[model samples]
Target: MATQPVTTRIVLASRPTGKPVAANFRLEQETVRDIGEGEVLLQILYLSLDPYMRGRMDDAKSYAKSVEIDGVMEGGTVARVVGSRNAAFKPGDIVLSHSGWQSYAISDGSALRKLDPDAAPITTALGILGMTGFTAYAGLRNIGKPKAGETLVVAAASGAVGSAVGQIARIFGARVVGIAGGAEKCDYASREFGFDAVIDHRSSDFASRLEAACPNGIDVYFENVGGHVWNAVFPLLNDFARVPVCGLIAHYNEEPSISEGHNQLPTVMRGILRRSLTIRGFIQREFVDQRPDFYREAAQWIAEGRLKYREDIVDGLENAPEAFMGLLEGKNFGKLIVRIAQ
Candidate 1:
């Protein structure tokens, strides 16, 4: 008889008060149950840790439902089918799944997308070739609408989504300026990702540096890190400039309530009114219709050496919480992934 599998998982131990600590999560193991007809068993290979997972930790309402207390922390993963009762799957297939932070998972064919490892590394299924890349493409095509010779700015410029956003905008003929949190990331964004200019958000004179970088004004601003970055970019947005409000990692750890000291609604409203700005917040799923086009074009760009990406991989499932906490602090250099298994 074959040995049965076991799954190790991290669950939310409690809703976080502010920045999530390791105490907020608990790890447990369970014997894997046999798969029923139409179900497949998966051994997770990689787990993606993105900034938006912070919002899911809160009890507050948003675009998606909050993960219930003690539920597995939500995430996207790449896995290998270890066993299968589903007619459409086999024991050796690689797939993309929403398997959360677990070492293994059970899936019905419904939620698994088969992956071609020969075409790209299976890990890319959780990063560049997956939702992260799609988010950048959809936001640019549908909202930012970058035109040739226009200037575009993206915050967190060396990140999974922001890197893709800057590169795609450049491919569309926009002049791309990136804002990153450190000198290292700033240099990588400009040197590796091909941003026309890169600004270090941590610089003392960040606002003035940003203004100097985009002398013609910003035609598009991909909003990822908000707060101070938004403040600097607001005054530079040209009339009718497009702002795609994506993940706001800068404020994710704060208490949900707005503080009286930082209220800038009046100034923001006045700016919007004066400039006729088109600021739109979007969830990537809303642009599902463009996924095929995105996959085709992004793959072509990667093949042509016009687009690039990087990964910051941690070695174990146990380290996810710490790695995630660091991600919010801008400590991650690229797409953050936890390699759960070989």
Candidate 2:
């Protein structure tokens, strides 16, 4: 009889207080469990590192359950079916699964979405053609509702969701201004992503440049990095402007505080009331019904050269924790992916 394969996995060692570190994750090896009648054993190929995973590390309540101590670090992954007891999948089939930070995972074949390499690169199943792209599409369609000749601003313009938001808004005939951290990223957002204008948020005159870029008051704002960027954009929003709150990467590391001068709720509420603005926060899963529409349109746009995406891949599962930490600090150029297997 053949010996069962040994699987390498990373589990949550301790919850992070502010920023996650290597000590928060523990690596271990265990035998791959035998599949049941309806289960499939998956060999993870690519692991996606996203900002939302940071929120899950805390013990606080959120839209999703936290990653319990000693459990696998939660993430989305693309994998290959290595062994299957289910008829829906075969040994060589590639699939997208939420198998987290592990080399092997067992699934009941229910949550697996089979992937076809011929349609698009398998890694895209975890990136542009997947969650991030869907996030951009959903936010715009439901809340941002950008219209022709209107101006839209999105921060982190060279990133997965921001890049998509910019390009998609342009396709909808809206003037798009993007904000990125550095000169290189700003250049890419303008030249590669085709944003009408790109501002380097690190510039000393970032607010001035952003103001100049949007001569017409911003009609829609895709809020990604919500610290200083929000401060610059708030005053420039047109009356009845729509704001889709996507992420707050800048504030994720902040500890709970109500210190004087740190509270902006009063100021923000006053602005909202005066401007009659519409600000809505949402999770991608809430628009799961529109995923099919997103997949079809985004795929067509990619094939037609209207949409583009980039990825920054790090090799080895052991590097995932370090890569993820870098992601929160804006260290990655594009979508951060960990190549766990060939």
lDDT tens readout by residue for model 1, 121-203: 88888888999999999999999999999999999999999999999999999999999988888988999998999999899
**Model 2 residue 151 CA deviation in Å:** 0.7
Candidate 2 per-residue lDDT, tens place, 210-280, comes to 99999999999999888789999999999999999999998777645523357788889998999999999
Cα distance off (Å), candidate 2, residue 207: 0.8
Model 2, C-alpha of 183: deviation from truth (Å): 0.6
- Tell me each candidate's TM-score: 0.98, 0.98
Native RMSD of candidate 1 (Å): 1.2
